[model samples]
Structures are given as structure tokens and as C-alpha cells.
Target: MTETARDIVMGRIRAALAAAPPERVEVPRDYDRQPLQGPADVARFAETVADYQARVLRIGADEIAGTIAALLPVGATVAVPGDIPPDWVAGLATVPDDPPLSNAALDATTAVVTGCAVGIAATGTIVLDGGAAQGRRALTLIPDHHICVVFAGQIVDTVPQGFAALNPLRPLTFVSGPSATSDIELERVEGVHGPRTLDVLIVEP
Candidate 1:
């Protein structure tokens, strides 16, 4: 049988790999994991999120529906995840995510309301693990606005602490602020990749 060019190249590559060392690399994890001094603080989380240009609203459980309704514009259409609490969208026009809306449909929607898996206080990051109230990744990415409801109990003091509370295998989306990027000339642009506005409602007990 004649050896083709593709076969010749692959054979050489396989031979090279076979001759390479079988040793595994050990990574160092001595870096600081939880650098924060005190317990997980909601105030610190709110301040850090605001520093990232995302709006924060601290409210009690009773005010959740009303507060969310107030933030959205009149006649706006919102995308609600399948597992999201009904009370959160009591009076709003919400499209369910059970059927998994198309990207174009999601883009046309005014905003998305979701519940976060865990929140990192130190880095001001909200993680969505595609669990429960948090829908698929595209649901959050395609929308122009995102209104996430985070519970005070879900806040962790540091990144390491946050990781310990979640499943490593799940799809995680860490959002620090509104999607933005600066060009070579330093011109800032928002909504280039994800939502331009991120409004977080930190519901306290």
C-alpha cells in the first residue's frame, strides 16, 4: 500500500510522541486562595460590583417582584429561565426558556432575569452554572440586559471559597460586569460580546 502525505505526517508525529517522556507535570497551588480577612460580606460584594460598572439593588424578599418590575422599562419583554421563581416575574411579560429560544429571539427580547449559582465577593463575580434558575449560556449572552437575583447566603468571601461550593464539571459563566472591551486606541465599547447592562438585585434575608 502507498503511504499518502497525510499518513506520512501523522506517522512521524505519532513516532515523536511515542519517544517523548511519560512524566506528568505537577502544578503548584500555594497561591493565596481566600485572601479576604472576614466573612462573606454583601456590602463588599455590592461595592465591588458597582466598581465594575454594574448596578446593584439591595432589597428584602418581599420587594423582589416590585423591584424587578421597576428596573425594567415599560412594555419590555423579559426572558425567564425555566426554573426561575414565578414570584420574581409576577407582573412582567416573560418568555419561558424551556423551549430554549433562538439567538435572534433572545436578542430581540429586552432583558433576561436569572438566579446565580454563587457570587464571589472578593472579585465581584457572579457565576452561572446552568443550574436551576440559571438557564443555558446563550440565554444570558445574547440578551442586551441582564438582571440577576443573587441571594445574600450565596455570597462567598473569595474565589476559592466560591469554587468549593460549586460542581467543577458544570458549565460556569463568571460575569464581573457589563460586557465591554477597549480597542487599540482605548475606545471603550459595551455589548460587544454580552449584555451591555448588568443589574443585580441582592436579596437579603
Candidate 2:
């Protein structure tokens, strides 16, 4: 049988690696973790996230469930974490991922709604440490749509500020808008890596 192009390339890569193994270099981590900038900019976060084609909504805490219900398709079933607030998912059909749903199971759900670990205003990024209302990384990845609720207080102005609030030991997944990729010809495709649509609800007082 003839070797495929993929196998040939992989074999050459393996041989090259065996010939000269790369060295491990120490990464520097002495940067300031304090907030060099002022307070977190909620507006900046919203603007940047919207630039990625994500839908960003600012609403009161009381309107979370209602807003979510209205935004989602009628009769949609949402996947949620086990510890998600009861009020956040009120009046919605939900399947909790406490036992950890299979990929197919998660895909069957219309969307995944969860609370985030933190929000970075500088890069319009949402971080999840699998705590609070956030299930495993799979819960958000497998579903076609993800609705992440970020509290105003959780918004940080910079990466350092975001890091200051998080525990590095926990598993972290940073999402900046919906998953999208461009091919060599610049043909844009959505949901290539994760959710095709990302709806961010910013809860304010």
C-alpha cells in the first residue's frame, strides 16, 4: 500500500523530533497581577465582544430568565450546570449536566447557559473555571449555542486584573466571542471549534 501524504509528513516530523529534541525553557511569570488600569470598563467589554459578532445584552438581575426565554427559540431545551441558580433558568426546559452528559447528549440540547468565572474588558473575554454555574468545558463546546451570564462585578479591565481574581489551579476556558475560523482563501466559517453563536448577558444592578 502507498503511504498517504499525511502519513509521510507525520513520519518526517517524528524523525526530526527524535533527531534533535527541543529544550524546555523557563517561562517568566513576574509581571504585576494588580490592576494597572482603573476600574473595569463594562462598555469596552460589550463593544469588543460585539465586534466578534456576538450578541451582548445588558439587563437587570431580575430579567435574566425572561430575557433568556425570549432570546432562545420557542420550546428549546437548555443544558445547564447542576449548581446553576434556580432563578436563572426559571420557566425553561433544562437538563442539568451534573453527571456529565455525553457529547451527543450535549449536542441534542438547544443551548448551554451558565455563569462565568470572570469577564475581561480589555479583550472581551469570558473565563470559566468550571465553578459556580459553569459545568465542564465540554458543556459549552459541544452545544451549538452558549449563553453566558456575566455579572458586572466580575468584569475586569485587564488580563492581570482577571488573573488576580482567579485560582490558577482550576481548569480555565477563555472564550472571546463565538468560535470562528477563516480558511486560506479567507472563507469564514462559524462553530469550527465550539459554539456557533455566543449570547452574553451582562447582569447589572
Candidate 3:
């Protein structure tokens, strides 16, 4: 067929598709359901996180501050995000988050505590960003131990579901476990690029 004839045919097909009734399309099935069983899911999630060499703790809301204090040594500096709950570190020697802390300052810090955006159950990942509870990316990277508090409301059953719950505009950091690396000779090492120890506190609402 000539080029002009092919163009005409294509235009007609496009018009026909546009003119078709919307009701002719099949409805997509619903995939968002309670994919997890009661109690079992939460237990499994904690176990999975621990299996990655990360420490996971389930605690009541009232115990948060005490737990944080215990994780950090006395007089040890801690970096806390601006939006972190004040009560979360009521008695700890926490340093308020300031912009562009020096590497020396960070190295001296014992821990960094921040709130997470979401916790993925299937992969046991914690997502964070430079948002309200989570300070700048530096806060997470520089500390030896990272204490992330994940509210139960923020936990999702699957990764796809977690993505759906996240804001596309915000910067996101996905952490599966503590930072580690292995040498060419197969010797394992920890704290190569990020915190060597990750302490996750899953707080119940």
C-alpha cells in the first residue's frame, strides 16, 4: 500500500478506539488485601530482620525512651532528627540535628536515631528519607549504630504495597540490613560504608 493509504488506515483505527465505549474494558482485580495472618506476620518480620544480622525489638510505646537510652552509652553523642518524638530520647545525651556535621563529629557519635518511612515485611527492609523524623542522609551514614523506630502503622506486608504507600516526590533510602563488605580473600567485614550495627525498634501503637 502507498504511504498515504497506510496513514489513513491508522488514523481510522485511532478514531475507532477513541470512540469505543468505556464499559467494554474489563475491570482490574483487587490485589490489596490483608496478606498477613495475625501475630504470625509480625513475629516472622522480626525474625527475618534479625536473620540479616540486624537487631530487632518489639516494644510498647512507653518503653521507647528507656530502650533508646539503654542502647546508647552515657555521655555518648547521638544525632536526632528534628521531627523525632522528643519523648523517644528524653534522657539520652542526644545532639540536635544540624546541617553538615563534620566527619569527626559523626565518628564520635555513638548512635543515630530516626523514624522510618516504612518497613517492608517480605524483605525486612526499612525505608527512610530526609523527612521530618529522619534527618539528612549523613545522620544515617556516619553513625556506628543506627536506631530506627518504625511505628506499627508504617509497616507494610509487601514491597509493592510499600511502594504504593510511599510519596514519589520524597527522597527514599531503602535499608535491608547493616552495612558490610567482604574482602577478596573471603574475609567478612562490617561497617564499611554505613552503620556496622542496626537496631530496629518496632513500636506498637
Between prediction 1 and prediction 3, the one with superior TM-score is 1
* Model 3 C-alpha lDDT per residue in residues 1-205, reported as the tens digit of each score: 9999999999999999889845766778576654444432566568778878999989999999999888877787788876788999997887777666787887788999999888888788889867778988888988899999988877878777777778978888888889988999989899999999999999886
Q: Put the candidates in TM-score order, highest first.
A: 1, 2, 3
The whole-model lDDT of each prediction reads: 0.92, 0.93, 0.84
Per-residue lDDT value at 136 in model 1:
97
Off by over 4 Å in 1: 1-28, 31-39
Task: Sort every candidate by lDDT, greatest first.
Answer: 2, 1, 3
Candidate 2 matches the true fold with a TM-score of: 0.83
Clashing residue pair totals per candidate (backbone < 3 A): 0, 0, 0
Better of 2 and 3 by lDDT: 2
TM-score, model 1 to reference: 0.84
For residues 111-166, write the lDDT of model 2, one tens digit per residue: 99999999998899999999989989999999999999999889988888888899
lDDT of 2 at 3: 70
